[model samples]
Target chain A: MAGIPKPKLNAGQRKSQRGTEEAPFVKWLLITVALLFSLVFLLLPLVNVFAQAFAKGFTVYWDALKHPDTIAAMKLTLLVTVICMPLNVLFGLAAAWAITKFEFRGKSLLVTLIDLPFSVSPVVAGLMFVVLFGLQGYFGEWLADREIRIIFAVPGIVLATLFVTFPFVARELIPIMQAAGSDQEQSALTLGANGWQTFWYVTLPSVKMGLLYGTILCIARCVGEFGAVSVVSGHITGKTDTVPLHVEKLYNEYQGAAAFAVASILALGALLTLGLKTWLEWREAKLETLAQQAEQAITQ
Target chain B: MSIELKNITKQFGGVSAVNDVSFTVADGQLVALLGPSGCGKTTVLRMISGLEMPTAGEILVRGKRVNDVPVQKRNIGFVFQGYALFKSMSVADNIAFGLLIKKWAKADRDARVAELIELLGLKDLAKRFPHQLSGGQRQRVALARALAPKPDVLLLDEPFAAVDAKIRQELREMLVNLHHELNVTTIFVTHDQEEAMEVSNRIVVFDKGRLAQIGTPREVYEEPASEFVARFIGVMNVLDCEVREGVARCGELEFPTHGVADGQRLRIGFRPYAVQVSNDLMAYRHFAVLRHTYFLGVLLRLELEFPSGLIIRARMSKEEYARLNLTEGRKISLQIRQYRVLAREGELLPPEVSVTHHLGPSPGDGI
Candidate 1:
């Protein structure tokens, strides 16, 4: 401490200090704009739907819950989300691992292909799957000949949901995996850990939180999917209609109350997702603190 | 425990980072690969630890060829300069990483982790995360992690570079004691000559992807094979000289020569502390102080100006300074406590120059 003297700030340094003081204000301004946009565009609509759904007291809630069509749509949406979320997570992990952890020709092109669905219209995504597996599409003829239904059926709805939500997990995971670097994996290899052990003990643990967060987002997207599911589902009552599609069908039939009731259920899922996001952020912070302390103890 | 690197060469897109560098580390001996930045000291360590494979040549551990062996199979412990502790694990878990990898029983792993926790003085902080610890503590965890496996060879890459100066000293002492107590073959890479000298039993001086010199710390310091080694291991004053009649003449002074014929031109070197200063320039020996006195705790260093205007440093103890009453603008006598006569074709001296001189108090002289 005595060897090196701290220099006093000059006029330029003082000006830079003033700039630093104003930086937080600029950051806060941007955050306020984002929060305002979400409140107006998202939270407001959700609140309106919930207020309408509860306006008739417990009668409307029980009536919607008892409706056969409403229950069927809810059940189908939950089933699709349950099936699609894990599939997307697996696909995302594989795609991210391939793009980031391995070297191959056209890797950039492959990444672009994985992200194609994000830029494509959801209706187009559904049509692309329809062309590949619909009754008159490529594999549709063979499937129909075998009496195996795809389009306008439950499987078709699930496939369309899968396509629309394809990139969610991989999109979240690739950057995190790349940022984590291969140092941990290399360290594990040097420690005599076989490939599987290295993955389970080191690589997987490092990316587990990222994987879970991405999976949650995937589930949210899968449950709320409408455009793609509508294109392939054919709106079969008590069968292929999902919750979002069911809401649209009810709204068109002049059943505004039932529409609002079903919309409220999906809205509840959005709230749950927000809660999951917050929990994931807290876990990330906790992990970071643990990492810092481990570093300190090691160096000490 | 001896390690041998035979003609090991690593090239990156037409540039050879390490070129045909060969050396051996005997069992239980600590060797430092000393060099300037980009001299491939770290590359050599990485190759030895199996972090990077040599593009050409073979690596043998204890006389067994292991060029293609995977890093983990090599059983070598590596401590990165940044101390790469797993951010997700606690101090105890980080140390147990290798033990867990080895599939040691839970009881054994726990016991080993506890032993290391105590050994590293982290028993109280075992549950702590890496971020909560200081720089020195992180370094200890990295060391403990590397040592937990009881590796065959330990490789450290600039281990103390990240720590504060105060902690660096403590870590250096800890490393010296650890090396002795563990008796593992250790290769430490550092650009700091003082650290290398204090921590290593032997030094391998590297320059431009080549082995400049390799010897014990005393050998390298006393008889540096080249000017690079001389300037690198410690402070030195290399003066241009001419050898004649078993003596090397530098400016106005002549000193006894080594390994060169008369009339051959060469370079002469001496340690700063070997030079003596006096008020009466002509009354003393064949040396002269140039200008300015520098205070280096316990010693006074004077920049001496030869007749040719070349500058050299001279160091004297405080008691010597008190007795002599040395000050700025005062004349002084200089001598070499010890030095090396480098070969002409060697990296230090030009081929046209052929002799060198080392002068100092003769053997048995207390001063």
Candidate 2:
């Protein structure tokens, strides 16, 4: 009877507060429309990828994944990610440190240049690399004389992936580093720590979580890059072919299940990356709440 | 002098943030750089700490010119306003960062950390991260960390600006006690006049990127060097008046001037504490109705409006208010005991030019 009476009271109270609330009909309509939109555009595509991958059987899917070409593509993609992650992290840390901690001429221009990869088309990036490193392009004769093969090789794929994923880590880190400020670094310096020591102990640790989050995003982008890598890879079967290029080649040759199987691996990787990002965000929020609680404790 | 800034000037792209400001901190003495926001007090503190290089000047620590010395080699302690404790580090670790960098023995470093932790009353918070501590607690941690290295000089930039009012008072007392106990040369920047006065042995006031006055708390308060210092340090009633014959008149208030040209405009200022009030209308030479009463704990600040519509603020104790039975709109007699002839902005006036006006018979009516 108490529970029943509570609902009745709540109903009256809600009706009294109806001025601030949306109409029930409009609310439900919007919710339903959003759910339907996600189901059609997001859920269906994801489900279709898995379904097509396993349409024949698990054996066919397993066989496709075990193919030498697919194995080569996986290894190549992993290699590229391993090579690109450290370089991008280094670049991101340097760029963020410089932009946030100092005043210099053309700082804004440097920031805009760091974001150039994000705005420019990946195809254009790959084409620029080819023009620079190809046999008929600038520095081509010099490179030929040294017997250096860059475009249409594993190095080309790595370069393409690097260019396409350049901004991910830096973009993630800039706002965090900016908000954290240089006070800690100054404190470190005043505490008898030199520049490199201060950065290693103070600045780097302060932005560790943000750097990790950014690195994850950068890795995800590096793993999935297609357009630029495609232009520079030259479709070399076991040498230059990345995961995406291999998937494209399999599909073009009517190996639909094989292609979808490889695509599912990428799709699964993206889902895992999303999960990691969400977890990082949750941890960051929890840390903030702890800080807020500390403040509240002080006020109390 | 433990720290001496000689003709220090810092310019950001030709816009000077700190002008040719020079000051010295005696060894083991506490000093404050006090001013309003954007007045370049913090810039002076930063230059001393070697955080910012002065475009033109020499910084000497213990009589050594340190303009070319890097911050790390300077061996100074600096506390930022935000208490920039490393977020990832525990309280103990943050305090020991400098010691570790200096390569102190593990046992000695631990002893120093424990000593600072106990000294700062952070016994139970040794393992707690920066985010897990309160603002006041974080401020103490920052102070302890700065003090851990036992540097020659300690510089703080607006140290208590981030804490609540009540906690700010506690931190001020803690800093004063710490400086006394350690006997370290300390210079802190603050815009709060009361905080500066309450803590430091001497205060250096700034106005528009230039040093205004540097003196003991009493000297700076009682004998302000300029009109800016007079108004900025505390509440002062300022009036612009023209000299007529031998008297300077603004409204109903008049001050006798000596050797001044007639019709010469002058700015004058007096503190509210200088205005004496009495309940009886005939007790003083002038009378006015009380306009407003502002309660400031033990003291009451009353606004007295003259018959000519000139209002002046007078401060008295609450006990005196009760004794006089003073209320808003009550008629009261008031007298300004002293006032200073002020110089215009950017003009220098000797602080000793304060004029004393005694209550005597004048040509005007006693009413």
Candidate 3:
């Protein structure tokens, strides 16, 4: 009772048949422009940083690493990172857990507030702490009488780094946790697991990947922070100067090879962070494959 | 009563998910809350498990009021629709999690896990995580995990909603067997009528957050309480009729409407198997033209179109249908041997079973 249907046209013919045929030239033009923009703006600058870093060779690089001020700056950066990273990680985990696991009034507003630091400029973030803790600012006389040095000290630098890099872990975690859902936690509770037990056995394991990535991003930003550290640090080399601040000081003093070498350390740190991120991704994929293999083995 | 909901109601935003629902289950009873999606069956199950709080009314587990008890303290195991296994933990560890939380001895926990693994037939899959198991196997693990703590009650939310038909039947059978062995009071939510019929002894039918009917599977199927239950539980053929002098009259068929008033509009429903068809001209006093016939392996489903444009579905055995050598447009006499005056909600609740409606020509005459 049915005749043979007409053969479906191929893709190109189908597009023209539907009267929505887009010009191929425009597509190629967009692709080319995107490629050119990325190459000129991103690729070129990254290449130049490394080229200038090793221009005077390995011995120059070694001397730059050995400089006392450079060593001091590295220590201070590491100190700030070591202190700020854990505090921010805890905050991120708490914030993500609260926002995802519960329903309360003003919850959406609370989430947006956590992301405020990411949108605010780093220099403006530094100025906020400086004003509150400065000699002539709020609580200034109280702190001055107490003989506590905060504005031009290591603590202020740490605070500035903390403010600028606070959202990374939380931002990474919230979406993943939201997608993962509360079924598992609810299951744990029904299984007689308390709130803490459910969080430890169920919630934390699910969000560990996000936590790791967020911690890495937080560390990268904290170590390389310049504007905020520059404002709060008072530019005191070998004391308050972080790695990026140290590089600026070296280049300003006409130490071209040294500055590039110091900048290269920051660049290398970034590369290492990138390496760790990829390794984590590879591990995750491998875990997935292994789980699939296990499933197949059971079926067989 | 093992568990009871006294006028429980749950409101989300401004709308009620569960409205003024009440039920009680005896000890070791396997019951099902059967309904369509968004019918609040899952919400009722959650309230029983203490995972969701009712906006009004009281919930009592055994004799204690558990309205304020959190899910952890309620000691009611819940199997989520997703199976909610710990993706990171092995099947054994997942089963052991509840025991661990309750601070059972390490030795005791292991022994319980081993016992449940053997009971659930997850022997070799003990070390495997959730993703490593098939859907049925994961459900078994979820069941085993829920049973690990030996809770007084277990609530399963659409436990077999995510499996193939063959596996679903097997799981249903397995669940029935498990309940028999353990004899723990259990309640499960499911939209599948066949699923509820196969596993649960008691089926609570819900429609739009209201409890339509609650009875044994056979009772609900054979004697549905309301029009909604009649259509929802099984295949039913309903015809709009008018009551005239205590008789519900359609085109030519009339069914006794015992207590219904005269000149009232009514709907009469009957199952397909209730229709008796014949080839004789004056066999049953009512005749229809056979519009279509489908040869199913177990039954022959026929659509009989009447002169009044009303179509009635009738099913007979394949052997019987083959002997008749039926075709389309054939004159067939039909007699609705049994029928129900469809019950309206809140009107006398459920109509009593009355066998006095012998309002048809003899079935022997139809042959």
Candidate 4:
């Protein structure tokens, strides 16, 4: 058994072998491996976040959060999330609608372009906006004449957040909406419901859960968005600093406890996102069950 | 006319889904658009309901041209094949959906919804979601929703196609009864000929994106305009025949081929019940071998094969098939009790030429 024997089988035999469930030991081994993977990749980092945040005890963590710079970072992060979520969600609705409802040319191209932001580096996304709006970039002269500060200001942070989180909602909705097709909406239309009515009543209700799920993911990305926001924010404390930026500043200044405390807030934000994501998944599963139940109830 | 499609042609890209189809549905008629799958019957239903825009032609609803009108303004209620009841909406909300969109007052919407719910026998399940209801129940909800808005006309695309046979039968009966009670210009599409024949006052038979025939169910069944209609409407036996002395003859049977000259090749068709089976050889000129006898409870179906191996189906009671003891491979005397000259080789025969030379005329004359 030290050197595994290669007693090969034909394709059919191999297929038949695959049909059986994994052995108890093998199943446990795989489960253990998966657990280890998640613990190291996901759980460990999460635990470390909480541990570091609480390293200096309750007062220090509270003080770190209440600090003027930290407060500014928190507000900026929340504002970025608030502003970014709706914009991405709006784009998501429009993109999902266009991709699913109508037959259009360059549809696949548009879809591919939607996923482009997901594949592109967040730094690259930030740079692309910077190159467009920075002093010496494409729209530089026009913006310079008005003395507009989008490069190292809140607007730049918003733009970077927007770019990073753009695909979340649309990505969630596209496949679901495509599978749904336009049958329900078409029914509404034939029943004297106008385009807007059909969307508000039929289309919106069906996609509401997926939209929420996507919006949650989008918010998670927006709130926790670091690389893109960092590259654009210029790290001007109490003015342009997001929580992640503040964490970096604190960490760079060797203020380990303050940094961890700020990191804990962002960690909590991440936890919230994960929690919402898990909840949305559960809700979707429940919806699926209800849908299946309806189908069975009808056919049964 | 409740709905009229004049030269309606729907082209999907370069492919014609419904080609030059023209027909008018008279008000208060239960007209079933009957055809095989992919025969564009659904497209016709959609066009009438304003769900689909015909590439060419005018759609008139209540004698007003609706070609430019959007589906919402057409005020048509369409029930889909899958029963397209809003899965998320409660049965009550689903029904109230159209009414709400139409801006009906809350009181009236409630009353109308209640009326339809009761009309469609969905009283107890009013508050339940679509997923909670049975298939038949969902269909009832869909019907209630469609009719709730008091649409000018109701169009159902394969309404009973989704149900089991027992439920389908029940639905058909209830639908016929509903039509009778409401008399609200309803047009339903179905591939089931029996369902169409049972539920509709008239049937429009489509074949390969064209209207093969448009008439009463019996007319379509008994005097089908073409071979496609005859075969599509019912179980039919078609045979290539030769014309002689103004009579088209298939094997030992002869049918008066009016306006058809001698030596012309023709195709004649008849329904399963159109063939007469007798033990007496003198009763019919044709000699057929009884290839098979199937006891279908109420009626016995027979497959009688001619010498050329051409089989024609005929049905009779158990007592009748039993009396003849028409066992397998037995030579039996058979005659064309009634038949129609379906086509003249390459050309379609006129509807007038649906003469039953032997029986004088169909038992249901206008049928």
Q: What share of the true interface contacts does candidate 2 keep?
A: 0.85
Instruction: Point out the higher-scoring one by lDDT: 2 or 3.
Output: 2
Q: Each candidate's DockQ score against the native complex?
A: 0.37, 0.70, 0.73, 0.53
Model 1's DockQ?
0.37
Q: Which stretches in model 4 have alpha-carbon errors above 4 Å?
A: A1-19, A284-300, B243-264, B348-367
**Residue-level lDDT for B159 in candidate 1:** 92
Clashes of 1: 31
RMSD of 2: 5.1
How much is the lDDT of residue B287 in candidate 3?
85
Worst 10 residues of 1 chain B by lDDT: B358-367
Docking tier of model 2: it is medium
Deviating ranges (above 4 Å) for candidate 3: A1-60, A289-300, B259-261, B323-328, B343-367
Q: Judged by DockQ relative to the true structure, which candidate is superior, 1 or 3?
A: 3
- lDDT by residue (A170-202, candidate 4, tens digit) is 999998899888889888888777778888889
Q: Give me the displacement of residue A206 in model 1, in angstroms.
A: 3.1
DockQ winner: 3
Model 3, residue A117: distance off in Å is 2.0
lDDT string for model 2 (B24-118, tens) is 88899899999989999998888888888999989988898999998898888899988889887999999999999999999999999999999
**Highest lDDT: which candidate?**
2
